[model samples]
Target: MSIQTELTEQLNRYSVDFIRFVDVSALPEEQNKGFPYAILFGIALTPEYIQEITNQPDYIQQKIKREAIHRDEFHLKERKTDRLADELADFLTQKGFTAYSQSEENLAQTGSYNEAIQQTSLPHKTIAHLAGMGWMGKHDLLVTPEYGSAVSMCTVLTDAPLETVLYSPEESMCGECQVCVDVCVPGALKGKTWNIKTSRDEIVDIAHCTTCLRCLVMCPWTQRYAQRPVAVR
Candidate 1:
């Protein structure tokens, strides 16, 4: 097998789903146009996991206080996912490519305000564009036949030349589904355009997002769907 395929296989051994290789050398010009390549490791955070966290006193207290927890505690259950991202980075470094985590802050720093605005559209759309996942819905989350939006994504950037796979972008499947938009307490979803720029323009007085995962947790699409086991190949 080729090196990239071997790498994908190795990643699969860790139960990573949807491994993709992205070539970002062209990003300077594209400027958030989309990545040339990206490795998408899918993680399904089940309702059980959510319930467990919700049951924690500290988590409940933090939620009540509307405070953000420290990263260590915030991602306590996601350590394995973070490690996967790190391991992928290390592997890419060994292969002579630079890699870094693409956090929201990182996105803001690299791209202009406009670029960041564009990113808020939908994670699944971005993933699907890279052929890492599938189409999204009005809830602004990706929907796959298997996993719904319960999947978390980690991306890997590399200079390595790898074969690309193409999947036609799926149409928006959220036909007349305004449940996500209507249920948002802070009204983050304003029907017209979900871009960050439009968001800022709509509510300049709002300081920050409510961070309420109401939109995330209340989605019928996510709750009703049966998740595909994301085992590493």
Candidate 2:
């Protein structure tokens, strides 16, 4: 098998729900960090946890409880993605390509903020969107056909000339669905549709967002993902 195909098949063992290779040369140097290629991958959140969060009472006490669940799961899944990215980077390095894994720790140390774009360094969702794995949702989250926004993503950059699938940037598939906007208690969601030029702040106000995950839980696409059979997931 070709190296790309072999590595892709190996990702199953790493619990990757989706993976894509994309050329990021067009991105700003600050974002791509001079890497021409990026591996963008995501791991879907546990359906059971999502269901619990979605079905729980919205009272303050219950909201806090579900928030705790959301926080813990996010950290757990983020760590898993971080480790997977590091492993993939090492694998590519062994294959003679210079690779750099974008670890949470490294990003944290670098303070993550890209002042120009008003976002964190090398947004994983942007790469995922470029890879045709997803589109930016109304809530400013990457909404995938398979996992919706219920996924944790990470990135690995390399100089390797790996295979890629080119696609035009996707427009919002959200249509008139305003479930996320209506469910957002903090009024963070703007109910706006996203396009290539839309900035994240245009969809949601980060300052007002409580990170309570109400938007995520109420999303129709995410609900569909949560309803999928466990075995199939």
Candidate 3:
């Protein structure tokens, strides 16, 4: 079996639900520019847990008050995401693929289309390009059909020469759905195009984003399972 196939199978054994490969070289072209690796996986989180966090009275109150608790909660969530990135990288590297986590510093340098797509010390956009995980949204975030703009992404860069999965570039799905823009407490998601820039020039503007997940959890498309009526046993 091909190495890519083997790797995909191995990742699946660990409960990784989706896997896709992208050629390292194909990423420099206009269609694939900015990234250098590709793979996408999601671990299912209970809908109840997601709803609890989003609907928590304290969570809503903190966001409304613009309190420090918002920062603390987001930091905790980010650390968990970072740990997942590390674990995935370790798994790939152990399998003899030269894999590493894409650095935050590298991400900062690759300014989204809202600004100019600047060159970073290490370009890692290939992962996003190859995974077919949706295009660069107007807000400079990766939007997926299943997750909308709600998914957390982590890159796995590898020397493994894997066959690439190609997907047609999708039009912005935020079409006329300004829930993200309208509900942004900090007014970060502004304009018809959903650009990510602020007057302060912060690339990501984490401070502005309370990570309230209002844009995420509140997304109509994100709660697909929640909409289904419970199956009475």
Candidate 4:
């Protein structure tokens, strides 16, 4: 079997639900730190838990908060992301390649305000999209066909000999829909549609985001129905 296929099997054993290898040669040499390829993996969220948001207002809010804990994978699962990344990195290294896994925790924290990327240790979502996993949602979160904005991602960058995919970043499907915009209690969402070039500030006010969970609850992908009632004028 090909190296990529073999690696997939190894990752699957670790509960990695999504896996993709991407070419990061075009990224700033420092961002990738000279790693030409990146391996991306994601853990899917439970759909049954996220579906609780469609209930009555009080029920929806309570369910969202309770489920958000699970959706974010607060305890064991949160640590699992890093653990799996390391395991994958080790697996790649054993194959005689220079591999390094990036911890999803504290992403950039680069201390640069002008650059959106400086906010995290690494843009795992960037790797996720480049890996053909999913696109960014209006909430500045990754949205996939299967899990919507409910999945968490981790990444590993390496100079491994495994194959790489041509970069075709996923496109946003938020379109003109404004459910996330309308329901945001903090009024953080600017209602702008996302694209490859869209930055967080261009659409949402990061400073104003209250983490209210409205956008998270209103997201159509997390619900059984993919559409929300258009906000009353």
Model number with the top lDDT: 2
lDDT of each: 0.54, 0.82, 0.52, 0.71
Error (Å) of candidate 3 at residue 103 is 6.7
Better of 2 and 3 by TM-score: 2
Task: Give per-residue CA lDDT, model 2, range 1-233, as digits (tens).
Answer: 67788678878888788888998989999888899999888788888878877876363346466676445676689888988888888988998988888877656666775545456767888898889887888899989878778999999888988888788988789999999999888898898899888878889888887777778867889899999876754
Clashing pairs in 4: 107-120, 107-121, 107-122, 108-120, 108-121, 109-120
Winning candidate number (TM-score): 2
What is the clash count for each candidate, in the order shown? 7, 0, 8, 6
Q: Give candidate 1 misplaced runs (Cα > 4 Å).
A: 22-35, 50-74, 77-80, 98-100, 103-125, 192-208, 226-233
TM-score of each: 0.67, 0.86, 0.64, 0.77
Question: On residues 1-233, what C-alpha lDDT tens digit does candidate 1 reach at each position?
Answer: 67678778877898755666544434353443443555667666676544444345244346557754444232442456556766776877787766654444444565533453454332324644456355554555666655566666655555456777766546656666777677665676654423322333442223333645545555566655533344698
State the lDDT at 78 in candidate 4.
53
Candidates ranked by lDDT: 2, 4, 1, 3
How much is 37 displaced in model 2, in angstroms? 0.8
lDDT per residue for candidate 3 within 1-233, as digits (tens), equals 77678667766675544465665555444523334555545443446645665567256556557866545444444444445556666777777776655535234444422224333432332255445666444344556665544454445566666677666645456666666556567876653443322222232344466556666555555556334466799
Task: Tell how far residue 130 is off in model 4, in angstroms.
Answer: 1.3
Q: After superposition, how far is residue 219 of candidate 4 from its true place, in Å?
A: 1.4
